[model samples]
Target: MENENKIKLFLVDDDALFLKSLEIEFMENADFTIETFATGELCIAQLSNNPDIIILDYQLDGIDQTAMNGIETLDKIKAFNPNIPVVMLSSQDKIEVAVNCMHHKAFDYVVKSETAFMRLQKIISAIFEYRKMKKELNWYMDRM
Candidate 1:
């Protein structure tokens, strides 16, 4: 049974199996509330509703996103909510692409595989820490 109070997650991926599998895995393993889409466009549409985290695939169908790939999507997502944590996911292991995605503000870029679930857990933990730190820093800055 899925817990009613699990952290919300919005996952974006073109592969249906990947999206569905990850959703189930996260739900079963981490007690997370998940909403998944097979395309970036759909995921982007739902992002305005304020999901706690976004797992975005580097590629999407029907969206000529290769030139910018996931970076363009990241820009748009950040524009709407800069503080919302986003983790980029891709089958490719190219460092340049990963670097570019990070430069564009992805919390982390993860390579998809059998260990993807563990990586995601680490990402969630890291993002949680990052947000906590940001809040602390913000509080300090306000006092200063």
Candidate 2:
């Protein structure tokens, strides 16, 4: 059996080009094993406990055989496992969307543009840091 330290990542987006490009970039430069889906429903189907982090596009196509969006998808994920880190991506720098995602416990939000390349690295680092802190906290709690 593999340990929890593998650090898998899943990306749910509708953009085909970005999906291909991101897979290439991460495979070339990052330590994470990446799985991607073109729609939220597809992502949900491929879901596993191994993915420590998820990147959610703010808008998604069909889910549940109905129109589904990222906010709703985020809610579904929270219901599944609130501890898994979710990073929201938006086409525009919408503060309201950011606030809503943060309220629902999204790890971070990144604008889907020039800033995306930069934010991806930062968010991945933050997720690893958060996991480390959480492990330390759990260890302390266990000993107490």
lDDT of each: 0.83, 0.80
- Model 2 lDDT tens row, 1-144: 354445688988887887788777777877767889877777777666457889998877633345568888788888888888899988868899899889988989988886686788888897788788989999999999
Writing each residue's lDDT as its tens digit, candidate 1 over 41-67 gives: 677788866789999988765334343
List where candidate 1 sits over 4 angstroms from the true fold: 1-5, 62-69, 140-144
Total clashing pairs for each candidate = 0, 0
lDDT at 109, model 1: 93
Report the CA-based lDDT of candidate 2 relative to the real structure: 0.80
The stretch of ten residues in a row with the least summed lDDT in candidate 1 is: 60-69
Best model number under lDDT:
1
